[model samples]
Target: MKPGTLRVWSQVHTWSSLASTAFLLILCLTGLPLIFHDEIDALGKAHKIEQWDEAQLVPLDHAVDVALAKRPGEVPIYLSFDEDRPVVNITSGRSADVPEAEMGFQPIDRRGAVAAGGGQTGGVTDFLLDLHKDLLLGQGGMYFIGLVGLLFVAATVSGIVLYAPFARKAGFAKVRRAKAPRIGWLDWHNLVGGVTLAWALVVGLTGTINTLADPITAWWRADALAHLTSGEGGAVQPYRSGLVQKAVANAMAKAPGMRPQFVAFPGSPFSSGDHYAVFLQGATPLTKKLLTPVMVDARTGEVDAIAPMPWYMKGLLLAQPLHFGDYGGLAMKLVWTLLDLAMIWLLGTGLYLWLGRIRKRAR
Candidate 1:
């Protein structure tokens, strides 16, 4: 690129990075612990399951009933399984459209005993999640952060563009530490940014997609969900524990290899008014994030059809794990943490360089 062109790109890199740096730093800091959320959660609430005979395991329907009984006037929205223990986590809400903040989580052991129960009011991790997701601005905050993500992408690209010229002249890792402080930090920033380029781009792009979750889900509910339940319109039936179990069974029968992740109740945003949406996922590491919704007749408990999620919805689901860097094993999480630290350093140096330039101009 010509020096003029390079200077223009530099300007873009400067402002773009500067504009999004603060928010991106916050996201990186918050996201650090989130990468190890499972580990942290286990550390916070350590519980051991008593060894029980197979016969002691309670029916899923009975567990759901138990969870519902604990929260009178509430409905079962989702039932999640624990991987390490024979524990079933039930999420109950006031209605099908209850906000996530208002939902309750109740954990039941294999013997149908309440294991852990609590309100869904998130604590520190939840606060970090909300801050990283949308600055606690709800959906609007998500969009704002998404905009910042786009800016980060642009900044990354511009940095790459500028790096080409610099790398051609000097070793990619050369930091010029013997020079002025500003020069040394600039070199360090360039080196770190280049090293973490791919990770930064992946996290940035995936994060941008994750921000579209609400819109994508809303569209699916209006389009795919509407088409699925078009001819079966009637008064929405209340979810019955027995029918829910039957629905779960029917869903597994249809999708032989998949397991139930959650069941969206009739009239819920994720399900049609006339059907139960049993969301199933594969058993493998990669396919686990890909959810397939099996629509079951809420009134009759008969399997209707497996709703094919659109590419956009699939991308959103896939982006979440990728953005969080939770898909890979412990090694991957360690690498992600290191990359996060590098990005933080990159941001700090970029800020320092920008301020130094301003100081020079003032002089």
Candidate 2:
């Protein structure tokens, strides 16, 4: 790049990183625990059920019945499975649209027995997740964080551009300790930031994409999902809990290789009022996040339609786990944690350099 172009890129890099560094720092700190959220949650959870010689898993409806029997007046909202064990996790609430804070979680063994200590939420882990996701500001906060993510991406690109010019005289990753404090800090910032460049970009872009989830889901409901259910009846009457198993079966049958991940009951956000949306996922790592919704008539337990997930929804699904760094197991999570710490160091050095320059200007 020309000297003038390099200077412009340098300016862009400085301003962009400075503008987003604080928010980015918050994300990094909060996200550190979130990368190992599973491991942390496990620490607080009860021990897994002892594996029997041959444990025959109960039907989905049986698990739902057992879970609801424990919490009277509650309705089943979602059913999730344990990846490693023959266990099912069921979430229930008073109503279909009840908030997550009011929901109850039940982890049941293969025999439909509720585990000793597994029906709760709102812990330190959840708090950290909420903070990292939205700064505890809900939707508006989420969008703002997303904007920071975009700035971070721009900063990353500009930094790469300027690296070519700035490092012309020095080797990449060189620390000029002989220089003044500001210059040394600047070099440290560049080196650490560059080292974590790929991960930072991936997390930033994916997080930005995730923040659009609300709008993207709204659009899907307004367009594709609505179109799929246009000819269906208006509001569906309340259906019995017995239909949960049938709905799961119908969904799994529709997608031969996929397994039911969760069931969105009638009047739920993900399902039409007239149907139970049984969300299925493939067993493979890549397809696990890509959910396919199979709508079943709530009253009749008949398969209504199997709609292919739209691109935007799929993008969100893929981005979430990727951003969380949970897809690659313990090794990947450790890698993510190390990179997160590096990002913190990079932000700190950048701030130090900026403050030093401001002090020099004032003097």
Candidate 3:
């Protein structure tokens, strides 16, 4: 590369890295615990439900009834199943459009129709997730984080471009420990950064995609489900007979092989005002996160339409698990954790080198 072009790339690499270092550090720190959130969450549980026969499991209506009994005036917003156990988590609030903070979660045991655990809403993991995702600033914070992710990507690409020239003489992964501390740190940063380049790019890009989750969902609802959502009836009332259960069964019948992931009640963000949107998941690991919505009539319990996710929605769904290493099992999570640690080190070393240069210039 020409010296002028090299200088411009160098400046890009330096400024971009500097601009995103703090936010990247926050993400890396919060993300480490998140990679193992499932394991960490399991530690505090006082009750564990044993596996039960499918026939012995209680009806979905019964679980919703029990959950509603706990909060008399609240309406059911969502009903979700546990993948491994005979448990159903019911989310309720004053209305379908209730804020998440005001919602109540009850995990009912399907075998005995009893409350299994209190709730998984507020906790350290949730706090870390909120921080990592949007810095607790909601939609605006997500956009900011997305911009930071872009900066991080810029830094990574520029670093890769500059690496070839730097390593031409020193060779790859060569650390001159006998020289100045900054030189050694710079070499270490480049080596580690190179080793984790692909993984970093993947995570950065996916995370940026994840930041647009709300907008993507909104767009999907407006475009794909416009026909269903534009219906005349008002939101369905909760506990109005056995409509919820029937709608779920109808949804399951429509999609024979898939399992019910969650049910979005009428007037909720995931559903139309008069439809129960039952989100189903496939059996395979890759397809499990990619959900297909089966819209059922909340009032009549009839199958309205099966809405397949659009390409952008599918991309968002796929990006989420890949970003969190949730696609693979424990082994993948461990690998993600190691990469996160290396990223932290890379960011730290880069900051150190940049500060050293500034200090030397000052003198």
Candidate 4:
């Protein structure tokens, strides 16, 4: 390459890579184990085959009572249902609505037995996953990580656009000899960055989209759900949600084959005492992650079809797995993980190259 042209392209590569490398490194490192979170969770009592009374399920609140009993001092923060098993999750933490502390989690089965040892963490691994996604920052962390992911996507796109000039038959796979000063690092950059482009771009873009989710949810509430729930005065008063067990039962009745993924109880910013919205999760290759909400009259327990997610939600739902590489089978997942490592390598080398640039100028 000509000297002037080389300088220009070098600057392009440097600035673009530098702009996102630090955040990208954090993302790449944090995301590695998260890619295999299922494997890790599986190791920590994620599933089981236990006996249950198909005739009468332990009531939602009652099952929660079982979990709370199992962990005496803990508050029941979040309750999750089992898709196949008779497992019920009772998280012990202060309610976001009713302010508390220490969310201990327990799992209970159909016969009202807390599972032998469910919700046990793998310590460092669990911490890593949580930190990777949320930086131990809760909602604030999620949003901050999301912004980093967006910058990553921008870097990846600009990097790829510049690749057309750098790509060569050998360059695509090249690692130029140390005999050449600039050529070697340049070759390494193209090789590392090019090879991992698919994975990095995926993680970057998807994570970016995932970050946009909070805003998207707010938008959905403002745009789509508002129409579905008109003239309700926005559930401002925190009404003590009554008969949650019944509301859950009614939600199940409404979404027969579908599954209840989550619930927005009364007094929740999402719902109020007058109504409850149960998100019915879909089951399909593509639709599984998509949520279909069913609203119930909290007092009367009538189920109403909740409005569809806006275009943004749909995009987010799809983008998440593509970015996380969670949908595909084991082999594909492995490929995604390997690529995740590659992204880490790219970020590392990209950082070193930029540092080298700065030091040379300083010299």
lDDT of model number 2: 0.81
Candidate numbers sorted by lDDT from highest down: 3, 1, 2, 4
* TM-score (all chains, Cα) for each model: 0.92, 0.89, 0.92, 0.80
Candidate 3: segments with Cα more than 4 A from true spot:
44-49, 177-180, 227-239
- For candidate 1, write residues 146-195 as lDDT tens digits: 99999999999999899887777767899787878777787888889898
lDDT of 2 by residue, 1-363 (tens): 777887788788889988998899899899988888778888956665466533366776777788889999987777777655667788788886787778888888765465734545788888998998899999999999999999999999898777775577667889888987667777877788778878889899999999988888878877777777775656644648678878788778888999877777776667777888888888888788888888888888888788779988899898998798887889999888888898888888777877887898999
Candidate 4 deviant stretches above 4 angstroms: 1-13, 44-53, 65-78, 91-104, 113-116, 120-122, 137-141, 168-181, 234-242, 252-256, 355-363
So what's the TM-score on candidate 1? Answer: 0.92
Residue 227 lDDT (model 1): 77
Which digits, one per residue and each the tens of the lDDT, describe model 3 over residues 67-150? 999999988899998876888999999998887788999999989899986566678999999999999998899999999999
TM-score of 2: 0.89
Compute the lDDT of residue 333 as modeled in candidate 2: 91
Alpha-carbon local distance difference test for all models: 0.84, 0.81, 0.88, 0.67
Candidate 1: segments with Cα more than 4 A from true spot: 47-55, 113-121, 230-234
Candidate 4 per-residue lDDT over residues 198-317, each given as its tens digit: 767766777767777767876776666666666464443232334557767777776667777766654443554356677777677655687776667766667755665667888888
